[model samples]
Target: MRASAKIFWILGVFFLIVAIAYGFVTGTYEPHGIETVGFPAILALSGLGFMIAMALTLAYRKNSINPSDDLDAEVSREAGVQGSFSPYSWAPLWASLGAALCFLGVAAGWWIFAFGIMFAIYGVLSWVLEFSIGQHAH
Candidate 1:
């Protein structure tokens, strides 16, 4: 995690530098179009990366040690069941369908958007409660 954080931080700094350099080269302080906004947008993305790195670093500090941080750690040492995962599910498909409908609504009509929202809600609820009942109850 420490290593990962460092890499992201470096990337963020590199992007920030590029944005500054681009501003100087282009002689533009304000974005008048997409082309002018590219560097700043990249800078924002890099800042997000840096923020993520910081979060990881904080988490690492709390945990103190991880397999990747140990030079002598073997793959087998870290190999184990990490968490429970559903073997099969239809929620993702439903969610995607809803998303597609929502996008379609954007181009077609508001009625489609309403149906999309309802589908999205149903899909999310079913997905979230999948394990609360039926054969997969837990």
Candidate 2:
């Protein structure tokens, strides 16, 4: 986690620098008819993402209970399963279908758009509750 914090800090600062550079470049450059606001905003948003990630990492590090920040501790002391992994599920397929419908709705009509939104919500809810009431759930 310490290593992750360090990495995040470095990346966040790097992106912030790049975003500032982008702002300066866009500010000084001449756009005949092209839009100049979006690119810099995107870059700035990317920097914000990195910065937010860094902040979250730092908060987690501070509140961490185990694995004391000891220099003498060997690296292998932290080896373990990091997270849970589902072996198989149909949730992804449903979610993907919903996303496809959303794309189609953008080109079709508002009725399709509304249906897509409802389908997408159902897919998300289905994914969240997939293991709650299923026979496969433990």
Candidate 3:
């Protein structure tokens, strides 16, 4: 779990850098709504978030509660549980679809701001769903 956390932190930073670069290259100076600050601000904020999450984990390392802490118990409990659960794999699919839709909306000039808003909602939903449900099922 600690390793996974470190990997996620690095991945988050990579995404943040790529997002900022994409915005700059496309000349979309503003990030959703933040004015003069622009995409750089968004990138910085994302990096900050990742850093904070990593810091939290490091700070709590002594008392860290990871899935491995109860590996056998968790495995046994899960072995007995059965149900038809929604596979959260669809969340990423939906989010990518939403991103495509957002791009088309921007290109067609059909509610330009709507794309940003929709993209934000889609991103949030995708992230929440993956974080809350995806890992447990697998």
lDDT scores of the candidates, listed in order: 0.83, 0.71, 0.65
Candidate 3 local lDDT, residue 68: 48
**Local error of candidate 2 at 34, Å?**
10
Worst 10-residue lDDT window for candidate 1 reads 27-36
TM-score, ranked from best to worst: 1, 2, 3
**Stretches of model 1 off by over 4 angstroms after superposition:** 22-40
lDDT of 1: 0.83
Model 3: weakest 10-residue lDDT segment is 29-38
Q: Model 3 reaches what TM-score against the true structure?
A: 0.33
Query: What lDDT tens digits, residue by residue, belong to model 2 across residues 1-138?
Result: 555666767777777777777666766774743237765675666677687677768677678634645667777878899886555777777777878888888898767777777777887887787777675565
Q: List model 3 lDDT by residue over 2-117, tens digit each.
A: 65566668767886887667676656545554344556766776777687668756755866565544554465543644565555455656567667777877788778547656
Better lDDT candidate (2, 3) = 2
